[model samples]
Target: MNKLLLGIILGLLAGVVAAIAIPRHHDTASANATATPSGRPAAPHDQVVRLGKPETATQGSATLRPVGAATIEATAHDPHGGPDWAVRVYRGERVLTPRMRQQGTDGVIGHLKCAQLGRIHDGRFGWLDARGTFRPTPPQWGTSSVVCSTPNAAAPLIGTLSPITDPDASAARVRSTIVWGMAGPDARTVRIKVSNISATTQRATPHHAFLMALPARFGQHDVHVGVVYNNGHTASGPANTDRITLVARAPDPNGGLPYGLVTAPSIVPGGAARGETCLFGGGVRVVGDRAGAVDYRRDVLSELEVNGGGGCGSDAQALRKMTCLPGIASGTGDTASEGGDTGGTGRVARRTQRSRTTITMRCAPGVDRVTLQTPRDVRTLVLSPTAHAALAVYDGQFTTGGIRWTAHFQDGHTKSGAVPDVGF
Candidate 1:
């Protein structure tokens, strides 16, 4: 009886051991089946994972949250709902996403970036408004700081002249003030050169203001003001010139004063040498018989209107005398006048004369272009290395009343001169 009982106990113990081992083996197999290829446990299904890095972008009052690396999922919010009411993503100045309207809300979600977003620098999202105005946002993720320094370029120089006060057309004098924009920091010194067809004056100041007492003369009186900055840089202001007209005042019948017009000497014979014309007066003559001449008459009606005729009767007589005088004649060759009737009523018949004039120009060492300006049209000519060219001048009823020349140099410098006569 004792042996049988011992055997029975051993059998029960073996059965219990087998059962425990079998269950342990099955549990190991189940765990192995769920494990990754690298033998690590699989991640949870709803776990949050970051792929690469985070970035931020801010512009105006709006700021964007960090972006996801694998996809473009970001939020942009404005505390004050700035003027830029549209949101978009950008890689520098280039747009990365289509513009979306952000209305009735302070924040917007942008679906912008892609897997390659990591390749961009200072990548950011920005905002725009209906007016096509853009506001940039700071980079949310960048290798360097998102803020960039402002450009240090210089601003253009501009100038304005104060209204003339107490203008005395008879005395040929006027007072005015000229104000120019402040020079940039790069300017070592600021200087201005004021010039007209007849005279030129220069003044330098630490500030940008200049006062002047101008002497009004006849003809198209234009004052050219140019500024010189440091490093030999120069710029010219807009063409703002004053036109002066001198009307002949009739002599006092009672002999109170001499009754004569003060014609500029240069316009008259034996005044200045050839190539010099009376810029202040309306007289131009070319010396030498070879120089052709063209008859040019000033628009008397326009002049009368501008000067408010001293006295209709005397001014009319003066105008008649002016018409009788020979008009501007070009000095190219023989003189011939193509005659035509002035466009006027039969009662006041005026003769129109036309003549051909030849103009020869010699360019400065580096002049690349030359522009000829006449009252009727402007002609521009490109100069070759020879720097010599000739232009034809026609004097007619519909021709440019006056002539001017401008030369543009290779170094970006420009010089201008008034064409005194037909020949240059």
Candidate 2:
């Protein structure tokens, strides 16, 4: 998977080329054609509407009543070229922006504000909802305030994107809806539907999923390099300084369609031949020398869509589980984990969920295996470090429930395991 942060590096290159490139195409039809190769019809813009204000508290089918939620549904066309599309709901400023490709890697990762996303110390599946909302939190003074300065802290999950519709065309149209109602007294959800979108499809395992996180930062820690099998025995290989590699067979027992997600560089022109359920979800753990130097915060924004638009990849569903080793304190947790070394460099600051501390780590180039622990959540695990050094979290316990899990490596190895740790 091409690191979304790489887009920033590319964006920088775009500026250099923009001056010498041919004139921009002004034909809407031509541009639309380039954006939508799937032959799907575009949904009307009116389909995008806000449902209503959320109620303070309301009963639902479950014990936890929704305090606030919004439902938005609409359809929109894929004006750009891509294979898939996703509606990303973000409460703070945009992380991956179009202009990012022009900036340096540091500038790109800076936008993510990885510090505020929460803690890997807990060892639970920590992440900003791909579609969520947040409210502002009281500003902390000094680094603290800088770490948690989200604009709409109260309703953070405010942005969303349509799903990837087709894989055969250069681009596919999409329709999607975003819903929010997790925090606060008023429970509501937002639903927005879009249409006529095209997205790319490739063979991905763990790394492809990590690319979606965008603007990643590697903490100053020892990168734990090893081969993780589904059986639960991780062979500590050499510490990965460049990119860690994992190769597992496709989900299909017969190896059809390379049934998993991969990077854009790995995909063929015709797309996978079979096994279309491959999906990714996981995180990384780094062991660093300094703990205080480590920062675990992140702010996912609305800009920097893939292929110059918006969308992510998907594949087979798998179970996921995370253990929090309190004893473990390697600054190597994902940007969301305990602090470590900062990967890129920049001052593009964005806020996160109110009160949430933002830890911005440097974006590394590697593969993150996403473990499917439950139907409601997914955990992405990184196989290596971006800088080819050692840094990671340590003394952490894990919490897992009822779910089956699998691990695929770059060397064509595979393993399976039951979710670990029922109670944390």
Candidate 3:
């Protein structure tokens, strides 16, 4: 079972369902089987995965086109040695099977050459990009990536990296998808969710792509970009010479999966696939809102994008415990909420510098609204008194479950009270 061939077969099945749901268009969502936290098989197709349109298959100079909507369904075995896997693509009611090489009447699929782009950073799990947008047409969903296997690997081993001659494309890797759904005619907000159902953990990069036909000279200058979180505040980055790169630490060191990527063949202007060259001007500009910094670089010609600092094989587990604490502000110069602390846990004590001016406290479980105010220099007030006493911080959790507590600063001393604990 070659990954490319598997992709074609799965694409055909997905096309059938896609054609029905969206006659003029096709939609794709990736799904994975589930397993217990203790490493036991749960059920087939237990996890529902989705990939939004215009997602980036790999971070490289070559532009990757959108393939068909792909859905992966794997079934766990009783012995847990291996899982049954199947991939499906959606076009119209006409679901076609993946073709390795076209034969006879298979011209329709054969003409559409689906070149595998790259896998996600975690090995055995990646994505494929075929050519198509708006509505899928023949030759649109040609290229695909399928699962391959290797020894002691959690991520699916991806098949070969077509067009590009890279020896690393040895195995098939598991691939994940990002899904976005919105409500209302205005499309006010979209609920974006992602899942990793393979045997490995997949890192999801949140990105927004703008379609623009730049003048041939466009690559000459850098572009300043900013992204607005669900909150009204925004994080701005310097003019990026290439693309953006943002790295997030894994939740648990051992819980994350191993990922890798290799550049595929480049698509020339005349529709010919050629070996990729360094002359192309394409890269990324990664920014860290929490860290309040930015880093940019050229597109990865054939490199794996790993999270934090280590490769997927590296140990990500933290040597020290990371703590989440909530504090309140009462009598202070200025109390502002800085980014939460890291690498401290279990009644960890923290100190603020005098120049800090504003004292922001990280919150524990069940806390919300942190407040800091000044009595003498009202102008120096970080948070108004109205925002004081009632202020609290959240338990580090992205959503829900907060804590209550207070912070007071006097005699150049700061003390916090009533901090609760929420184990990670």
Best TM-score goes to which candidate? 1
Please estimate how well model 1 matches the true structure, expressed as its whole-model Cα lDDT: 0.31
Instruction: Report the C-alpha lDDT of model 3 over 165-184, residue by residue, as the tens digit.
Output: 11011111212111111111
Give the runs in model 3 whose Cα sits over 4 Å from its true position. Answer: 1-210, 213-411
What CA RMSD would you report for each candidate? 37.5, 26.6, 26.6
Tens digits of lDDT, candidate 2, 1-424: 4798899889999997986686665575445333222233332321211222222322222111111221111122223321112221122232333443455542222211111121111222122211121122211111111222233233222222123222122112222222111111122221222121322221122211111111012221112222233434333211111222222212211111111111112122355433222111122211111011112222221111111000112211211222111011112223322122222112122232111111111111222333444433454444333211111211223333354444544454555555333353
- lDDT ranking, best first: 1, 2, 3
What local distance difference test score does each model get? 0.31, 0.23, 0.23
How many residue pairs clash per model?
23, 216, 73
| Model 3 residue 55 lDDT score | 35
Worst 10 residues of 1 by lDDT: 298-307
Candidate 1 residue-wise lDDT, 1-424, digit = tens: 9999999999999999998878654664345433322233322221111222333332343333434322222221222222211111222222222334355553543332211111121243332211122234334433211221112334334433221111111111111222233333454444444453343333333322222222222211234445555668776544323332222222111111111221121322443443231222112122111011112210011111121001112223442333211113343222211112221111122332433333334344566667877665687766435312223234342344567778777888787776555332
Report lDDT (Cα) of residue 142, candidate 3.
30
Highest lDDT model number: 1
Reference-based lDDT, residue 137, model 2: 20
Please give the distance, in angstroms, between residue 29's alpha carbon in candidate 2 and its true position after superposition: 4.8
